[model samples]
Target: MPTASVKLAVIIVSYCNVDDVDRCLKSLGRSDWDHFEVFICENGGEAAYGKLLTALVGADRTLQRASDGASALDRPHKRLASVTKCRFQNSAIVVRLGLATENLGYGGGVNAWLEPLLGVLGWDSVLVLNPDTEVERRSLSELIAKSAEGFGMVGGSLVFDSAPDKIINYGLHWSRTTGRVIAIGRNAPVGSAPSSDDLARIDAISGACVLATRSFVEDVGLMAEDYFLYMEDLDWGRRRGKYRIGFASKALIRHVGGTTIGSAVAPEKRSHLSIYLSARNSILFARRFAGWRWICHFGVGLLFAARYVLKGSLSAGRIALAGLLDGAKGKTGRPDVAPRPH
Candidate 1:
């Protein structure tokens, strides 16, 4: 029997990664838990929405439901996104595609679905997932179990999809002293647990895979949209109020890291956007939460920019400096640069 009591809505805020969304939807289709529906917000706008429809059809050629067939009350996020293109009722998965007219960044994209899904459609919980991640069959079950254990927000273990034995992170460690956000268990072997020392400084869970109860969201409020992309998850974690955060190592997931954004094994080879947003968000975060220590965050941004210069990536250094200046000038929301392509 389905756990009708636990109404979970898995939210995936996708930019332009239709293929990744397809694979992720296929993965979600295998979930053992039977009380959840998926809402994918296509933040990449109309073109990506077209790609999403094609991918959805390819993912499941079984049932087809046109937007005109759905009632206004049945389809949530339609007020924000376009609407569901097709649906699959055979498995536990129910895919609803939300097409945005413009890029909503990460937080904005996720927020587009939350208000309507949690309110009008009526789901008690939401699991924010990256389109590039494929969760384990028991992932949802573990997250719900952890949340039932009293955690208002819960995160699962994330391993690299390319190197399944290597872990991406268990959570995140936000450094006040150095203004660095380090993955708690970066590159560690699979199935390893975070030590107490590591857990002590884990200020936030990785946004790659996080679940939150409706009560916590209603109390703490929705994720801040000011951070259009990076650092929004850390900001969300810091605002948990009286609620507690937890980790479910058993809820294993494989993440094709930085799919929408370019990445490299080496720090110097990372994309300009990644470097820029990281440096900018650090200062913005400090200013809002770090009191006078915002200066330290600014200094850290300078250090980051210098790293690129030392590594002979002057263009990256320039972008990093721009991010620092923008953050210092109280810049909020998405940068004016074009997003990476699908």
Candidate 2:
């Protein structure tokens, strides 16, 4: 298919953050690119939030609130009319909303939309975006242009939404020996760009904003749902062989990091859900990909748990240990933990 004719499908999976989603949609409305579609997978939020999303898009469609035990994939597709009908943009920019009966987590929510999007809608490329991100007007265009150059997967440069000049992550660097994944260019000024060599070959891209071709998805498969929240991107990147992963410096996105999980700076304020998932998924990912190196990670995890305990954050340490044990047993999905005060 011609690059110009190829349609890009932007898929965003959201939970309860209606305001963030609204901002994302507004930013998309200002895009200079014309041929694209937006899919919002509402993964179990309040009925009021769903209504708010409908109002923001100004698209008329019957909204259905999912009940208990209803799977996200089982929810019917709700097609909304194009809010903007200009000749250039026309109905070419369409927004579709899908309701998940309950929270499917990040990977599952994306998978719920990916099947119909690529299978039924027949879009050429798909961009998996976080609900807490806002893309620059030229961001989609830059990503599309880079993908056309034979890169199967491309990531946009992500900067903090609060401090637009600072970089959150360009991509990631995975260390096999340590069984650790580090975000490249994190907390650095955006002006300090990585060398062209580093940008040309990235270990993995942030799931916050990534574009993947249909062929790439078919070959590598969708995000592993086993990980409800963290490290699923690293798991996806491990499959990279013939397909190249790249970072597009021109494409920019602003991210409000940890909106769902709570702020990273305040460990005391962070959610038990975030802490447990990170701990569990890291070990699980290491065991799956790093083999014997998982032992190294386990040791490192112990030190972390010990520190939390020494610092008097007993709950944090306990949660970490619980995650480690569960991961060792190959258990997955949301843990049954009580909600702690932020």
Looking at model 2, the pairs that clash are none
Predicted model with the maximum TM-score: 1
lDDT of 2 by residue, 106-217 (tens): 8888887786555554477889999899999988888888888898888877998889988888788777777667888888776466677766546778899989988898
Provide the TM-score for each candidate, comma-separated: 0.92, 0.86
lDDT of all the models against the reference? 0.79, 0.74
lDDT of 1 by residue, 242-302 (tens): 8787888888999988888776346677777777787778889888888888888888779
Best by lDDT: 1
Q: When superposed on Cα atoms, how far off is each prediction in RMSD?
A: 2.6, 5.4
lDDT measured at residue 62 in model 2 versus the true structure, 0 to 100: 21
